[model samples]
Target: GAGVSQSPRYKVAKRGQDVALRCDPISGHVSLFWYQQALGQGPEFLTYFQNEAQLDKSGLPSDRFFAERPEGSVSTLKIQRTQQEDSAVYLCASSLALGGEMAGYTFGSGTRLTVV
Candidate 1:
């Protein structure tokens, strides 16, 4: 089974550009999650989805951040007008349940976004 994976592994953007990062989760898994991790910090939950339904999005820093899992499998996280404060490692993860767990989710390598 293929685990979670993200594209571009790294991203560089100007302060007001839009960027989209993609995530391909393990086949047949019903759960998906997104997280943001700053330098030297643990990953923080951004949003979660069970199948195609978004269960939570409270951790998304601003309206500029959006995410979706349309088919219950592949997901995308889009950040509009990227900000220097938004620069961080964007991680995608999946699990059996759509909730952030102390141990259930398996993390992607992450897309490290650096804004200037």
Candidate 2:
């Protein structure tokens, strides 16, 4: 794809339901990231992966949230037992550089998840 592509642009989940959001990054991009954005708030880092190795996931809100990039191309973020507080826009981004290297991130149109 020419740019980052995310699936299910909008999602509505009932409380306690699980949801998986997918992100297909640009070809050859080595860094993939996931973020959570609350209503009217800036995106907050959720996790980061370098290639197929997850480098940082300290920002994830809880154990209910998990992110992975198995082949270094496509990534999925799964949320289990979704809560009302979990309703937010999930953003995915990718870059060509490694950690500490300055590179512009290409972001996808986030998947907005609403829990009710």
Index of the highest-TM-score prediction = 2
Cα error, candidate 1, residue 27 (Å): 0.5
Q: Give the runs in model 1 whose Cα sits over 4 Å from its true position.
A: 97-103
Q: Show pairs that collide, candidate 1.
A: none
TM-score, one value per model = 0.92, 0.95
- RMSD values for the candidates in order, in angstroms, are 2.0, 1.3
Writing each residue's lDDT as its tens digit, candidate 1 over 71-109 gives 889999999999899989999988875354544888899
**How accurate locally, in lDDT, is each candidate?**
0.90, 0.94
Model 2 agreement with the true structure over 1-116: per-residue lDDT tens digits: 89999989999999999999999999999999999999999999999999999999999999999998989899999999999999999999999886536768999999999999
Ten-residue region with minimum lDDT total, candidate 2: 95-104
lDDT of 2: 0.94
The lowest-lDDT stretch of 10 consecutive residues in candidate 1 is 96-105
